[model samples]
Target: MTSFFATRLAVFSTLLLGGLSTAWLQAGENPDPLGEKTGGSTTVYASGKNAFSFPLASLEDEERTRFVIGNSFFKRNWVEAPASTTARDGLGPHFIARACASCHSLDGRGAPPDWSRTLGPEPDATVALLLRLSVPGKPAAHEGVVPEPNYGDQLNNAAIAGVKPEGRVEITSQSIHGRFADGTPYTLQQPHYRIVDLGYGPMAPDVMISPRIAPQLAGVGLLEAITEADIEGNARAQAAAAGPVKGQVNHVWDAFAKAERVGRFGWKANVASLAHQTAGAFNGDMGITSSLFPQEGCTAVQIDCLAAPSGCPAKGKTDKAGKAPEIDDDTFGQVVFYQAALAPVARRQAKDPQVLRGQALFAQAQCIACHRPSYVTGEGPFPSLTSSKLSRQRIWPYTDLLLHDMGPALADGRPDFQANGQQWKTPPLWGVGLIESVNGHQRLLHDGRANGVLEAILWHGGEAKPAQQKVLKMSLAERQALIKFVESL
Candidate 1:
């Protein structure tokens, strides 16, 4: 028994050391993944001694306030409403689910598939909905290499039958053995989603597929407040700086502008703004009509889209020939307002010495490169998000709002406008500690594959592979400290 224990410990130490060394090397290069610098910035708030100030009180109010008192009034999911129609009306001809809170659940993160229920009829019922994409191969802009296609985007198993539900969406995850720098052998779960359902029928067998998990909604306003010049400047600085880390901005089609623009939303940074993104959710996720997406889903081509007894009425039509109430843009806007205003919960205030040490190590390892510590918002129309209030607030969202190549291992093989298959937006980490409490599950990443925060970090590759490798080399105590720090976020 003693000999066996010694062997295991030796192997573990090798894996850990290997992982940490790689991370440390990566950190020594350009440390600012988002390319942000702290030179001429003024203090946003007095109490908050950080770069971004937190408006705790106003944030709390935004989450609690309800729309006017009436049947048509809007309210957060937590508040009670008297009418069922209000809840039921927004359901889609091709909706994944009703209500923003349904997917986000308490405005928090979503979980991955429940393996316990895997063999059952519903394989991915309770998990967050994943968006898929497929396109022909193209030339790479940066590397000047030819792009290749893999599988397809998402598997939409649940569709309205009469509309010939688009293609079948399926996922198959495999476990791969990998050795950490410390020599610890760990099994990494790699997921591959296969798309069987095609609206137009058999797609090119070589079509590429990409999967994206819905992310949490907190602290988006802060991300929006970051100036475009700041983001572009940071990207340029990182390229010029001494770091293995590199990031770029994805310029995607702005439906609102009817032209391509810088992407600030979506896992791939494929959206330009929150309003456009919200409109997309209405059209893509629910097949609901909006000003941006005015067409009804092609039900004849997708049987599942027509499965519901009553087909969706034409955008401007009603059973009685009178003008129909305008699309609920205000209701939609209010929800976006609520989402943009939702305050991030306080970071975990752990008193443990080990956790405190891990916090410093996290900085040293350069995890903060992509997961930026804080940012101050510029002026906005909303009182809560205006420049004065923003100037007084300091927030820690832990993201750079830029795209990075995450390596082929995690690539979904689908292109979103300018973002290649391997690129993704830097997700904010604030309020992540309460994800499980609010949503009852802890699936991490854009598609909810990682089982926990540690797994999520472990799966990092491409630009972040160095960080992941460094994490593997830490002492067990240090690893614990790093995890504790993340938990506090």
Candidate 2:
């Protein structure tokens, strides 16, 4: 393990040997100014509530026009089938939300539903958090998990007028307490889930349940711009080190590419590209269909869901194959572009003394092992469709985009393709500190259990246990410095 003093000594040697002034180091001036530009030239300096909603500054007039159109579609609510608004009709017979923005408000992190309100409603539907259901068996083609016989892959708590909703999810929390080295107390909330008021007869006897919360959408294009070679290089280096921090790549079947590719999106790295992820969200979350997922989200027993009308008037676009997706390719592509071009917020107070001390502590704890600092992005998977603004840029997303065994406490106990129950992809930390400013909450982790940065740190185990232990041993000042540094990013 690299000691904090050793890292400081190494930095001093490099700066002094390179004939740089020692005063520059003492003043907390970042040697790399590019660090301030979190998403390269694409980065925008917005510290307010709308920080996560900005588009890339490099976008041309035409692209900016498309971005505005796409933003409209993203925030617009979908109506039930056979509505006058043909473009945005055909909402779910069963669904969790009406629009993409319902879950991902202002392109920021999703907070778990308010589980406290129990006065009038029999069961509560979550606006942001949703449960994924599967049974023990081999995965189907393209999709890596075996969908539940009746409920299918996802549980929809809200449905259209004639159809009964699948079920509602209720969450309860138990507090786990711990203390810092200086005897400062800390508390972490552990969330427990329960499904009640089933509309379907019953789920499979041995069904596996995994709860997923929508993540922030900024800087995804830059992550997509990273090459497969570079991602594999991270895995290879970790393996060669023979250290406790072994990161593995998740290779899943890509429906668009018609081949197995490195999974870049989704909580378990289950989805391949931004396009596929967008289409899947439309189909699964809102029961809206596109060319990629033309079929409705109905199992054999869902008679009303199967029979529901999919609205597409004569004015709407249709194909020669008689396949009419609720959303046309043109509108769908616009949403994809908007998502891919949303720039990450620039870092704040990066040179502050307290934040700098925390940064050293961050490295000392070896959180840097999995949360890799930076990468020079490459031409993306769909270079033809994506903007040039995404390519060949230095970015600091603070993730390796590889799955690691996060241990049992954080595990959902549901396996996804190359990711086992105990494993999860390292989520990007670029816009993390600004989640509260944008979304009015600070929920973190896969299930939105952690209330803040310190709570999230306490929840880490397995390969991250050592880092958690290091943090546990740090002084109160050191802990505050670490959190302050993280918040600045």
On TM-score, the leading prediction is 2
Q: Report the C-alpha lDDT of model 1 over 170-237, residue by residue, as the tens digit.
A: 55778888776667677767766555535556655565656666677656655666666656755775
Model 2: how far residue 69 lies from native, Å: 0.4
What TM-score, computed on C-alpha atoms, does each candidate reach? 0.74, 0.91
Write down the RMSD of all candidates, one decimal each.
9.8, 4.7
**Measured by C-alpha RMSD in angstroms, how accurate is candidate 1?**
9.8
Clashing pairs in 2: none
Q: For model 2, what is the error of residue 264's alpha carbon versus the real structure, in angstroms, after optimal superposition?
A: 1.5
Q: Candidate 2's residue-wise lDDT over 1-489, tens digit each?
A: 235544563554332212223544575645453267887778899976788889887778888888899999999999998888878998987788889998888888888866552211222322478889998899877778999999999888888888888887778878888888788898887777888888879888999999888999999988988888877888887888756999999999877677888987999998878888999999998999888888889999999899888867323556676548888888888899889889888999876777667777787788878887777678754453354688866678888889999988998888889888999999988888899888888999998888889888899998899999999999888999889878887
Cα displacement (Å) at residue 444, model 1: 1.3
Let me know the TM-score candidate 2 reaches against the reference structure.
0.91
Supply candidate 2's per-residue lDDT for 338.
88
